[model samples]
Target: MSEKKPSLLEGFKAFLMRGNVIDLAVAVVIGAAFTNIVNAVVKGVINPLVGAFGTKNLDSYSSCLKAPCEVGPDGEMQGIQIMWGSVLGATLQFLITAAVVYFLMVLPMARYLARREAQRKAKEGVQETLEVTELEVLKEIRDALVAQRAGGNAGPEGSPAPGDRG
Candidate 1:
């Protein structure tokens, strides 16, 4: 008996041809490109504007220890050098990225989805209205059939005509 091995090319083709896989690939590429653009904007425009406010590029906003800790005979400092400025800069970057992504991408996406949902509901409303109208007509027909079967004039017994119903 001979065993057949699956072709790698066939598997690759199938993976690439899947709908969700293709969408994910496209999203990843677009996300990478968007990240570069956001980084450039942060580095170029926002950083400079922040620097004008004396923040100094968001990376130099920390204070260093004035008195250096004692060093060993080998000349290495016993105390650690705190790089809090880098952490501040990273936090600022994260905030800016979050704000931009929310305002530029997420907010608009939510608005667009809401509008699309509203339009879908509007369309469904029309269908529902038609269904309700048909139901009302059927109810009227059923009432008439019941009245006819009872051998009455489809009105309350001993009731006057429409003009005299008051």
Candidate 2:
């Protein structure tokens, strides 16, 4: 009997139910929530430290493309202004977030995974192969052949050697 094919809806449902998709969805939610914490750290800690260089808030830093960057009493600018403070703030926030994620989460998780895998391999008694040179392999093969020709009973520890008839 021919097997029935899954409908598009069923296929889509299966894809949505995959572990990675669910994990990605959860990660997106958690990342959105974690943004507040990162932002708080940047604003409360990093911003002050950076502000010691010039201003408390990066938004105050600007460059004027045209002459007379002065603003009127109504906050109307007289020339073109490059708000580099906003760029600095955004860059600082991104750097802080990346550093925190790398140091606190990514680094630790990678270390843990590496340690776990090593431990698992050790538990499974998986021995790492020695780095044998080509010459060493050739020597081993030569010794086995010599022992076989000499009939010195080197038959792979159990079976008959190469020249043996049955």
Candidate 3:
């Protein structure tokens, strides 16, 4: 008999239908949405807080690297200027995202998986005990049958018990 191979489309469909793939897609979508929320919080809350110390806009903070760091009439820079405030803002955003994802999503998921694993192990232990008990009962039954057969003998093959009339 010849076995049929799946088509490319069928293979792709099967891949997409897998649980991990669907879960990953959902996670990506949720992460994108969560990023928007994080960005809004940083802009609305963090920026204002930092504004108390400096400017509300992080990009406005910079340091001149070379001399004559002047802007042209068309609003172009003439020298190298390092915008460290923007880097600091980006770093803060990343830290906030990482902290929230770890504490809320990753930590809880790890705890839940650990609990599920413990429950599975407990169930397997009970099943193993039941299997052992069943095997022992079967052995006892087999031994009892053997004893009964040995104690009561008909004779050799094609023969009857002593009390039977043939």
Candidate 4:
């Protein structure tokens, strides 16, 4: 009999029920909240520190690439301006976030997984050795029984050999 195929809704539900998808959703939410904190730190602490040498607002720092850049009374730019300072600020935030996540989360998880794998392998090795030892003992017992039967010069139950009795 041909098996019935699952419907599209069933397949979608199964995908959503997986642990990885739920974990990813949670991570995305947390990451969004973390971005806000990183943005605040950049705007508050880092900006003031960098502001010591120049303007405090990173977005305000720019260069006239076209040499005719001008801001009108309505705060409209007339030429191309390269905003390198904003890019630097964004880069710093990303680096800080990445470093923290790697050191605090990724590295420890990796080490734990490696340790667990090693323990599993060691346990399997012990079980395999025990099996091999048991097999060797069984073979030894079988060989002894075969040799005793072949000799047959003595009777059963510790009695003297038939030819030894005078």
Higher-scoring candidate on lDDT, 2 or 3: 3
| RMSD of candidates 1 onward, in order | 7.6, 8.3, 7.1, 4.6
Identify the candidate with maximal lDDT.
3
User: In candidate 4, which residue ranges exceed 4 Å CA deviation?
Assistant: 1-21, 155-166
Give candidate 4's error at residue 15 in angstroms.
6.0
lDDT of 1 by residue, 83-163 (tens): 676786667677877898899999999999999999999999999999999999999999987766567433467665344
Question: What are the Cα lDDT values of the candidates?
Answer: 0.78, 0.87, 0.90, 0.88
Expressed as tens digits, the lDDT of each residue in 75-141 for candidate 3 is 9998899889999899989988899889999999999999999999999999999999999999999
Error of 2 at 78 (Å): 3.0
Candidate 3 residues lying further than 4 Å off, grouped into runs, are 1-5, 113-166
In Å, residue 39's CA in model 1 sits off its true spot by 2.2
Candidate 4 backbone overlaps, count: 0
Candidate 1 lDDT score at position 59: 71
Q: Candidate 1 versus the native: TM-score?
A: 0.66
- Per model, how many backbone clashes are there? 0, 0, 0, 0
